[model samples]
Target: MKRTMLAVAGALLLGACATPSTEVGIALFNDTVQPLMVTGNTGTKVGRACAKNYLGLVITGDMSVEAAKKDGKITQVASVNKEVKGYALYAEVCTVVTGR
Candidate 1:
């Protein structure tokens, strides 16, 4: 009984430290783009803000629409997108924003 309990706990903890994935499906190396939102107008300006993870240990970045908007110098938000590229050990998550 103790062995079974230990095994279950170990399995749960094993995935707890796994790196984040960008793809919706299960893949070791995933690079995917997902649409977040769309307004009536698709603005002319475009910007992207990214955050990165290291070995699933350290993660840092401003992956926010506001950051993207600031990067693009946008006033009104017309659309938003999310992009992810993950390689088991490292990962990059980005927010893409478009506006006027």
Candidate 2:
């Protein structure tokens, strides 16, 4: 019973702690999302690129501004956005770009 109680307490603490992507393995969940305006000029094309994380071991995909621009077939970037979400042993990050 003591072990069980201690485990529960530890889990609670871990889950309650703020987790950054660099230390995601220690937390139960994490999330970070935001929008960014790169330039005042607006564009009509939109593109997105994403990367996935598994057990914090393997990460695959291209979550870069250049990748997003390429995916959208854009030459000029006007805005950018980023999103991150993680749960348990899995996480994903994505980048969104808008350009002309």
Candidate 3:
């Protein structure tokens, strides 16, 4: 009976140890875009790259620029195709740092 109790406790502990994918997903998104050039990259490029990398790390859901915009997840608006898109997004993200 003691062994059974111990096993149950261990199982519960192990189960609780399972990593939470939600936080990881958000972190993954933050990490992917955090290091990029927030000034040089266009908004579209930033949006696409950020979404691709962030969503790519996860096992589910679409990560396109349109999807991001649709979901209102992109705090900055990027161009649809021009390099300016990425640059715009970068500018938005780096406003505090660049003051441009």
Best by TM-score: 1
Model 2 bad stretches (over 4 Å):
1-27
Which of 1 and 2 is the better model by TM-score?
1
Q: Model 3 over residues 1-100: C-alpha lDDT tens digits?
A: 9999998876554433232223234221121223212444244323332221111223223544455455444555533331111211121111111111
Candidates' RMSD to native: 5.7, 4.7, 12.7
State how far residue 9 of model 3 sits from its true place (Å): 0.2
**Where does the lowest 10-residue lDDT sum fall in candidate 3?**
91-100
**What's model 2's TM-score?**
0.68
The digit string of per-residue lDDT tens for model 1 on 26-95 reads: 4546788899999998699999999987756788999999899999999999999999887756778899
Model 1: per-residue Cα lDDT at residue 21: 48
Identify the runs in model 3 with alpha carbons over 4 angstroms from their true place.
Answer: 19-100
lDDT, residue 19, model 2: 30
**RMSD to the native, candidate 3?**
12.7
**What is the C-alpha lDDT profile of model 2 across 29-52, one tens digit per residue?**
767766866898789999999988
Best by lDDT: 1
Q: Candidates 2 and 3: which is better by lDDT?
A: 2
What TM-score does model 1 achieve against the real structure?
Answer: 0.77
Estimate the TM-score for candidate 3. Answer: 0.23
- TM-score order of candidates, top first: 1, 2, 3
Q: Order the candidates by lDDT, highest first — what do you get?
A: 1, 2, 3
